[model samples]
Target: MHHWRIDDARQTLVLAATGERLPQVVYWGPALPAQENLATLHATHAIDVTGGMLDANPDLSLCPEATRSFPGQPGLIVRDGEGTPLLPKFCYDSESNGNDLRLIYRDAANGLTLTFIFALDPDTHIITAQTVLDADAPVHLHWLAAPVLPAPQHSGEMIDFSGRWCGEFQTNRTAWSAGMRYRENRTGRTGHEHFPGLIIPCTGATNTQGEAYGFHYGWSGGHRMIAEELQDGRRQIQWGHAARMETEAATQFKTAPLYITYSPSGLNGCATAFQRHLRDRIITWPKPDAPRPVHYNCWEAIYFDHNVPALKDIATRAADLGAERFVLDDGWFGQRDDDTRSLSDWTVDPRKYPDGLHPLIDHVHGLGMTFGIWFEPEMINPDSDIHRAHPDWALGGEDQTLGRQQKALNMALPAVRDFLYDRMSAILREHPIDYIKWDHNRVLPMPDAAQTRGSYALIDRLRADFPQVEIESCASGGGRVDFGILQRTQRVWLSDSNDALERLRIQHNAALFLPLSVTGSHVGPRYCHTSGRMHDITFRAWVAAQRHMGFEMDPRELTDKEATVLRHVTAWWKANRDWMQRADILRLDSADPAVIAEQQLAADGARFVVFAGKADTSAQIAPRPLRLTALDPNAQYLISLANQQDIHHLSRGTPALKSGPVTLTGRYLMANGITLPWSFPDRMWVLEGKKL
Candidate 1:
């Protein structure tokens, strides 16, 4: 079952059973426990945050303010929330004097969907409650029923782990996220041992010490994901990871958690934690239509202002070199370089190509290839033809409407959203275009589009508009990446940070519950982003190969050696697409920067391994016993590899892998580990194995 074992400290829960359909969703969280002490909690009134009765009650605490609450009514409100109304569920005033919180879950029963509300209180150590009906129509309730974080005041003060934790944001290049923190017993008497839900917010409250923070990092951007925060002296707590009642698609959410020193003693607990339950279903996008293998991009070659011929040349070279789709990154449509004009025009620049975009599409298609184009349609240039034609289309700002690139669309506006729908749909329908790299460049600096009239209606229109389109969400690089979006699209561009080793951390965190298919991991060049780490192209590709593998560099620019290696890698992913695209991944040395991820598909499953030797101090690696990840225990796998040398293998498999009762690890041949060319670039190979 894809349910959570919240009662267990280890949180044992299955994500998906083999042969399960993709885009599978599973709910986790301990079933509501019987309340030993149930009592009536009351508040005079609840503020409507969905712009319905939207207003700032300076009297009450607001978001980014830990103690403030975005009060919801006694019942839930779920109107086919397109994007505004934020979300169906919201935090209401819990009796802890608004400082305390109670969580509520609302489901329309139409889809068995759920919404959350977080009301947090720091004073009496008392967290209160609510829940809305799971009936048809809008659904709302108290956002949080149980205290995700125990009231700090009631708990012993021997050690307060609750404080703002800081770390790098997995997506945006220029930001850091911080949230409240609190520590729980390693093993608690209740089901949860370490903690129920640990949150580190970007914006929240602080003391006169000027240390209290707010969950404003991503918020100031476009506020796609909502978070609330506050501080209690050195100890802080936050309510982040909030979804707008009006939300995007479901996805592998990179709940970018932060870890900081509470008392300068350094991190006192395990760096890992889980709040959500595993989704039983896997999400699958159709394999690359043209590449035959999952495609990659070379935008690294041309960020924007990509010259037509240059791009054409890149596409031709990539296709010849066995590459699939050559994605044209930002700068084709609007007056992009400086963000000036023509966003509503969705046309190929006449100057860039006298022949128009059709020629390029034709050229790529002519080469037995597919063409992909990128667009930040959600945004508008302050000086674009669209804005000029209809100024009202842009979200009107009183103080100043937030704009990413000159101007931003009031996605909350029906006409504006319809304009987008018509423009993009018409473009794709008219052109020979096979793929659309739909990107949301920046979070609305003023995410109050919902503040406008009919904003949610506009969002509904957009959702209905782009079903056939293969859109990839990019909140400035993976910030908007999530399961909500996944339901509509095939994959997510994991993180904008192209650090290969950093990817290990991200992919690990993501795959902890997400399926292997939804991840879009690309093999990029060395100049990308190196956090003082050693990264060989081989290592990068190997790490990426585990997911939906693709490349980000222009093949024409590749060194002779690099090109040769990439060609082989491309062929490998193609030949072993069956295994690479679908398999339970096994990593031999996950902790080491260098990792070897092997996958064994169904017996009829393809077998492949992504070898990234990031941690290679020596040229030689001792191969040891290798344990299979998703192979049948009793099934015999005839692994065919090795130089006939002293290739020391890995020592052993996880004890679970060795257990016969566990089908995933049992039948598969358990070899120690396989060693590869430590010096040579990484490799993706299709190993022929037989089921015992």
Candidate 2:
């Protein structure tokens, strides 16, 4: 067998090929020494079988061939116009760059060519793979996957996420059982039900120790991830964009790239590597040097009761509470007083804004805060003027299901795409809009490739024309949060539910891949609109301060006491926003499930912030000693309470926490955890420390 291999600093990928069979990856993980021979290593790991053995050398699953007996899912599935399956066989050609590798195969009988490409990021150990297919004549492609690998041995449990609108990013885990476990999202867009990332923990792995492997898909449209266990006790895993393909003349097919990474230092290590890669490579931070603005969105504050005078009052109060951006959410344009009608109409409602939004925008600007508005350009109500005028623009025929009283637009059509883009562009050109809260309220039934392509084209054109305007992606909130969408927008609304308790967990899971700076977290009203749970104002503000801080409540209705807390929280965020944006997040492990802790350590080791929250109390009354992570052990530090009121209120019915500044070495703090005063349910504390 001929062999080829690529080695980055931390990992290695080895490929092998026999006479005329296709090349397959035999080894991929921790790096081996350069002196070690690839051929010898493949021989040592390859399974050999005697007569009548189903697990023969080639079929023993070193990464199966499409037509062979590896028995899991195939990497490629296609057929010709004559209804015959197109199974690609090996061709004798391959090539490699320094950290990239490519292999070519073909089915000459079917006039089809298949090529596989792999690239590695040296620093983060992220390997990206893509597949390309070329056909001399028309073909029908049912399913095409990027790349597949044998699941590593000793991997115990699989960790994934599942949720709905208000309950986004709920973590789930199940034992790595024997059959096939698959996840497919056909929502036309990344749905809030599941994120496009998965983590497999090595046996007995924890948040801080052992090893973990991660997989993430870069596609934003319909996608699938599969984990199949074979009879021989091996597993195959793969992921890619999910599409229905029928070849056209002069058209080529390529699958979206899939990314994989491994870390020996466990889940935290995996998170740090991904966070670094995303912040440095995938996401383009708008105003990187500036702190994320403290926004006040009017969705929950005033809902559809948006009048010029009422909005002006909200703007004045929002600015007084230190909000830097005042966003008028929904009901400003069209006849959109309610969700039942008038989506495609882009003009401002004449009755609500007789002066054409200028007076309100001027008022917000005069208050020293930027003005932003909401737009759901890809939706249309059947009762709207645009829909009545152009009835063919909706996704399905008369039998289509309506979401939020609206239907999806047929973005695949050029005329429809042009109309939406022109309407949005005209608004930007006429108004001094600082930001746009772009929302998608529904999912397309059978979305076509043209629709995805058209959406990208429209966004790209809008960005090119208005480079200064920032956009936020919100699909019922947190429905479309992925690297693919983050490339065009600056921030994502994490979830529709602003319940503080739910957000603590949602934000924690999201921070696994996204930086807190790019997640939109806000303080909601005492009675959460979605969850219907009431929380203390202090608890809500403390949680929201960790992300791109915003307030989603009517500030004018806040009592004097609540107003004071809001002012304090905003002031604290302003003071620490610089370090928070650039810090490395560390999720800490606690003995109690109800007690969650996280720490943000500055990149330069100068300062750090610790957040300890208690969602519920246990049988014991005494508080446990909390140990901090990600600190310089040798350095001395001065620690103090960030908000004394937090301690005063939280410690009211329990033991009193010692006040005043304390000095301790980082080594001692990490090894021997600090014991704070007892706190009850629905309480949180913020502590800050500086190097001494």
Candidate 3:
């Protein structure tokens, strides 16, 4: 028997193999003593045989083999060049060292080699794993999962996500069953409907307590996830690209990295690990030491109306309101007056700016704000010049249904990719552009792995050439957000709906996986364009401040009072952004169902800010005390309500929090919780606390 173990401060993972067979992860959980025997643990991990089963249980190795009669879904599915299915049984070959483990397996008869890579980040406590397959000759890949991991037996339910265009990250909790809980996103992008994340919580786990396991597939393309429970009561999870997404035969195939972590400190532990890993390890920032600038995107303000004087005026007002970056969203290219035409035409509109984009770019620069331009590179409209010139560049059938009046470009074609690169690179090279609001407004006609790889190639090439520029992934809003895209881009436009009420809920749920630093939340027009809901400037500004603060509404329409409120909020956000950007967003469990609250605890445990948003009226008349997390029990904290001036007339009661700053022990704050004055629906209370 052979055994290996990987350990960090928070968790442990042990793998074992018998004879020459591939290894199976025998044990994984909270950290054990360094001197513990892994071999004995592996031996103790075995299960007994029963009727209707084989005399001896087959090891559910890293890549479960059909030849071994494994009951659940096989990890790898492939075919030969002539389309004959091939079941390659891999055997132990070799291993590597260091912080990462590379386990090599070989199938001599099939001329195939398999390698599973595992790396655990000591700082963030995230385990990153991937599987690579190599063959002597071309083979078609149907499905190839990352290193498979076992699910917790004590967990009763799992939480996945399902959402729409504006409503992203809505959590769906389902009970564990005898079979599989399968989910597949085939939109050809990391879809809005099915976010590539799963959280399995132990029976009584909450946001701030209990043990939980989190899994996220980092691929931006279509992906399939399986959380299965065998008849033997063992559970396993597998993540891979959508089945048969590979179009042509190939000699090599690789699964995207699967990021998993065991959270002893509940769901927030998983969230913080992912958050730190993404912001610190995945993203390559252009300006590392620079603070996150406040963004002002002119999409809702003036869609497709690119008048130079009007834009210059808006830029000036936005800068005056504390915006440091100005993004020129869509409608600057081709003859694009509307969404229907001119998607692939990457040139500046002559009618909108006859002197090209220089006049507007120069004006934005004069306003003391960096300039960003928007592009939909992976899509082309039927009325576009590029489509007219090369109809074959479009993906799928000619009669396939269109989304947002646009068809996806055949990114798999080098000719198509070269054309897009030439056009977009010319703009980036010529202009003093520092940012690109990269948008994918439509889904591909079909799910093809080649299309995603080609898109990734284009972005990678662009990033390498213009290393100073930042890119944001916005797929009609929240459609293409994942670790794969963030690996290249700096930020994500969280959603299209800027209604503070809706945003309060969406952002709360999304915090389970995303951090505040990479999430873009904007203060929309008083009348939200998508939802038609009107919110106060106070509520809007505070909600936007929860993430990468920005504004999408027209500055010209802001009332004097509203402008003052926005300015103060923006200033406050800037004052604390350095620490808040690195803070762990801990979701507070509010006794009142109507309140959605969270606490952003600084990395050093010195200070924290709690945003308690009253999303709706409470079922009970009085407000419930909200609890905070991750604080020293004996330490004393001075707490004060930051937005007390925004209190309404109805909130006349003199709650201790509203009266003045109060000092309380962390034990009391976590147990008795903080009480607040009653507020109306769609309102929010901000509390700032510091440890003494």
Question: Clash number for model 1?
Answer: 102
Q: Residue by residue across 230-261, what tens digits does model 1's lDDT show?
A: 23111223322223322323311122121111
Candidate 3 deviant stretches above 4 angstroms = none
lDDT of 2 by residue, 1-692 (tens): 77877777777778777665677677877788888887888777766566666756443322245667556677767777776776665465555565567777766766777777888788767777788878888777767777677777888778887789888988788778789888888788878876888888889877767778877787667777788887667677877666562223323677777777877767776777677677667666556666788999999988998888988998999999999999989998788878999998998889889989889999999999988889998889998999999989987777888889998888778899899888999999998997999898887776455566667777878988888888898999998887777778888998988999998888888877777777899999989879888998999999899888999998877889999999999999988998888787777776667777787888788999888888787567677777776677998988877866666544545322356768888888787766666666777877788998
Cα error, residue 64 of model 1, in Å, equals 23
TM-score attained by model 2: 0.94
Candidate 3 residue pairs in backbone clash: none
Model 2, 672: alpha-carbon shift in Å? Answer: 3.5
- Give the best candidate by lDDT: 3
Each model's lDDT: 0.41, 0.79, 0.92
| Model 3 clashes, total count | 0
| TM-score for each of the candidates | 0.58, 0.94, 0.99
Residue-level error in angstroms, candidate 1, position 551: 2.3
Please, what's the RMSD in Å of model 2? 2.5
What lDDT is reached at residue 664 by model 1?
Answer: 28
